[model samples]
Target: MTDVSTSDETQVDVETASESESSSYDAAQRRSRQIEADLAGDAGRYRMLTGDRPTGRLHIGHYFGSLANRVRLQELGVDSWIVIADYQVITDRDGVGPIRERVLSLLVDYLAVGLDPARSTIFTHSAVPALNQLMLPFLSLVTDSELRRNPTVKSELAASQRPMSGLMLTYPVHQAADILFCKANVVPVGKDQLPHLEQTRVVARRFDETYGRGSLKAPVFPQPDALLSEAPNILGTDGTKMSKSRGNTIEIGMTADATAKIIKRAVTDSDRNITYDPQGRPEVANLLLLAALCTGRTPQSWADEIGDGGAGRLKAVVTEAVNSTFAPIRERRAELEADPGHLLRVLAEGNARANAVAEATLDEVREAMGMAYDLA
Candidate 1:
């Protein structure tokens, strides 16, 4: 690395990078505002695409971070498509678990969290052939350097226990296929996922410019925009980003007793005074935030209520708040879990719907590239 203290050229390059980042942030903010306004007026006109990798059961972080937002969008009457990214499980991990089981479990979580199957088209990656088929044309639209430079890919690679697979390297392209397959115009995502969405946008633009010209349709895919989630990043019991891998998450499937136990063990500062200082007292604040989220109150207000009652009182309040909030959902989840046949049927229906949409999109893609030889 060049020393910025001694090298003027490196300093200039650093400044340019900062300016570019700032410009991108500004552009995203503008686009986000416009998308928000459009959704408010005619939400049904927008099709949203979002999903999880089916790595494991979702926790509170997944709930507030994205799942709840998904429920909100579905309730708004937006055409929602949820892809259970079962195939992407192997992107970084070497050994595979029972994906079908995980997919079913994931579905239960989605349904329990109010993601109605009727409103959102929920399907798995491996089940949708036409969706995966778009990978071939999209692969050519991007270069190796572009794929390598993607921040999400880089972070996944750095964190992976095994060597990076070809699928992992071209992960963003596959994601582009996910978005474009349904021509999804609105993708709900967090800040970290903007780069992946940007790559999807690039693919859509390049494909239209390259193929959707000269006797073909003007554009075959919508340039999807990111619908940024306003949810604050919920930290795990350990004060880090909540994750399944971290073993710190309080999963929705977990019993109330289990949740209380976990909260009791959460890390906090030595100071007994209960306060909402995220930077200074992140652990305590995280607990307060969890309680606040569950109870529909502000973290500071919760802290004020606790009023130096210390971590023990805070944990008790959080436990009750969480258990009370999720009691109904857990009951519903049990009902769903009892009927494996019904779960399978839900997957079947979702898969059928996704296949039909994907087939139509793929047909458009073929026609645009002049690959539809069957056409007279």
Candidate 2:
């Protein structure tokens, strides 16, 4: 009888887990569709918060996955805020090496990719003290166990195999601070990152409930909606997620010849019959996806064009597609790289603008919590 009870409990737990996952997926889809409709009619009404950690230069994966969307949003007139989360770089690393240079390189990449400073406000993490100040109140609202349970934190801890630092444990709250500091109503993210955004939403709601004046004072932060990328998962030459650490990434700043060399080395199956079978032939399909994104066409169509031409033909086509698509951007990058002062000036202006906004938000937060002692 005891054994039967244990088995029944296990089944119940599995069923609960499955139901929870399904519910989350459904909610995400609904939110995504709503965001799309909103963007079409009133893109200017939305404020977006999205960024990268300054660990390294971005690659094609970063471009399609998020950067392209950012440029599109800016062009559509959305108030965009791009943060170089420089402080987050230490979450898993033992030391900060050449971080300053990496941050500048990231700025150069942003300009090269058409992220104009006039349209999008670009800032870094360490420069905004008021933004980081939100962490204290936010940390008080959640339990330690909740932090440990966060999926991104859990994975990072496991991968690093190091003792979880306080900053790492409270990483989600820091992200919440990042979003709420600027009152961003929309954030671009992949499906896997929905959990992180959800935590941010939780923090926003809890802060309002704990400190807000109900009907008297409106909420300080919007529960930002997720703008899921429609971009395909781009695998690297090694048939894995493209990442710098794995030496499988093709940096955006690489020359045409360098890009061609990298694509030439990409893996493909021996079947030799070119087809877009993402499940069965992911490596070949990845190359096709890259070409499709570059040319604004379908991956299957690219596959059909290269039918029976084998891997050699597919590689050549992809190499040309990638190089031509980015050739103009590389030229701009080279021109910008020559004038480093302009890049620093861009950062300085952005930092000043971000500081003003963050300061105002922090004042509002203090007022909400009745901690505005300075007003006395």
Q: Which candidate is the best by TM-score?
A: 2
Q: What is the number of residue pairs that collide in model 1?
A: 0
Rate residue 133 of model 1 by lDDT.
Answer: 99
- Cα misplacement distance, residue 155 of candidate 1 (Å): 2.3
Q: How accurate is candidate 2 locally (lDDT)?
A: 0.91
Q: lDDT tens digits, residues 208-231, model 2?
A: 898875632788778899887787
Could you estimate the TM-score for every candidate? 0.96, 0.96
Clash totals in order = 0, 0
Cα lDDT tens digits for candidate 1, 222-338:
899888778877888998888899999999988999999999999998888898998898889889888999989999999999998988899999999999988998999999999
Off by over 4 Å in 2: 214-216
- Model 2 has how many clashing residue pairs? 0
Full-model lDDT for every candidate:
0.90, 0.91
